[model samples]
Target: MIEERGRVLSVEAGAVWVETVRTSTCGSCAAKAGCGQALLSRVGSGAKRGFIRALTDRQWQIGDEVFIGIPEDAVVRGALWVYMVPLLGLFASALLAQAAGVAEPGMIGAALLGLAAGFAVVRWHGQRAQRDPQMMPQVLRSAGQVMPFAPEGRLNG
Candidate 1:
């Protein structure tokens, strides 16, 4: 299980909207300042928030700090879906075009078409996955649990 800390923004029924900062595990690495991940992180320029259903039956108050978790398989599957499949589609289509005697300029168009097709498939898959509870992140622990959390200033900084 991969876990992250978040502050509860609101509670509706059993689900709470939790606000979390996207912190890089490599933020302190020697090469981070020159890395594209760091650059993109800076470009995004803000935190992300999402709603997760409470795992336990307890009623949670507003402003409760909690830990959210998603299974490792879900993270791995999501990464593959978001990165690998589209890349393969682009390269495979380009190669197929090349093998079929397509011109260099037209090969680029073939790759683009493949990429769009991959994206369409991904979009369809995402919509389908949205209806699956096992694919969603869940509340792992609540504030009353024996976990120590830092203040907002630390997380924001």
Candidate 2:
């Protein structure tokens, strides 16, 4: 499970709205100084607040701090779906156009069309996945409770 700490912003039927500070591991990344992402983070004040609605059965109050978690496999599958679909579409359509002896411009156009089709597929899948309980993040526990084990490399205070 991947987890983050957030404060409850609101409560609703079977869910809670959470506000969290967005954090990055850019400081320890090998390509920290070379990547555009790292540069963009440096330009900003470093911590930005983001809001997300997490599913939970337990009642929570507005000021409560909690831990939210999502399964690691869900994240990996999402990344693969988002990236591979478009790339495969581009290659497959371009190959088909070449085999059919289409002109160079026609092949390029086909590739572009295939890429758009791929994006359409991704959007469709995302809408469907939103209703899948396994794909949604959940409220794990209250942050104020003592952890069974201290996090790696950190000692309990």
Candidate 3:
């Protein structure tokens, strides 16, 4: 599970809106002086805050700090769908246009059209996935709460 700490902004039915600040690790990285990402990070320092609606069963009060988690597999799958689908569409349509003896200009148009269609598909999938529980992040627990330690092979008493 991947997790982040956030403060609860509001509570709704079966969910809570949490605010988190994006922190960059560039300051500690050895390649900070040579990395393009480090430069971009410095340029965008003002817009680091983000709000997320996290699913949770417990009712949390406003201003409560909590941890949220999502499955690693979910992140990987989402990244693949968002990137690979459009690329595949572009190449497949361009190849088809070539096989049909389309002019270079026509092939380029076909590739662009395919890329747009792929983006459309991704948008549609995103809307559908909004209702999928597995795709949503869940509130793990309040950051202030402590877990009881259980001894080896024994449950907490």
| Best-matching candidate per TM-score | 3
What would the per-residue lDDT of candidate 2 be over residues 1-157, giving only the tens digit for each residue? 9999987777999999887778889988998878999999889874587788999999988767899999999999999989999989999999999999999999999999989999999999999999999999999999884322232312245
Cα-lDDT of candidate 2: 0.87
Q: Estimate each model's TM-score.
A: 0.73, 0.86, 0.89
> Which model, 1 or 2, shows the larger TM-score?
2
Give the Å error, residue 22, model 1: 3.3
User: In candidate 1, where is summed lDDT lowest over 10 consecutive residues?
Assistant: 145-154
The true-versus-predicted C-alpha distance at residue 101 of model 2, in Å, is 0.9
Question: Candidate 2 versus the native: TM-score?
Answer: 0.86
Could you tell me which residue pairs clash in candidate 1? none
How many residue pairs clash in each candidate at the backbone level?
0, 0, 0
Residue 123 CA error for candidate 1 (Å)?
Answer: 1.2
Find the 10 residues in a row with the least total lDDT in model 3.
146-155
Cα-based RMSD of candidate 1: 4.7
Cα lDDT computed for each candidate against the true fold? 0.74, 0.87, 0.87
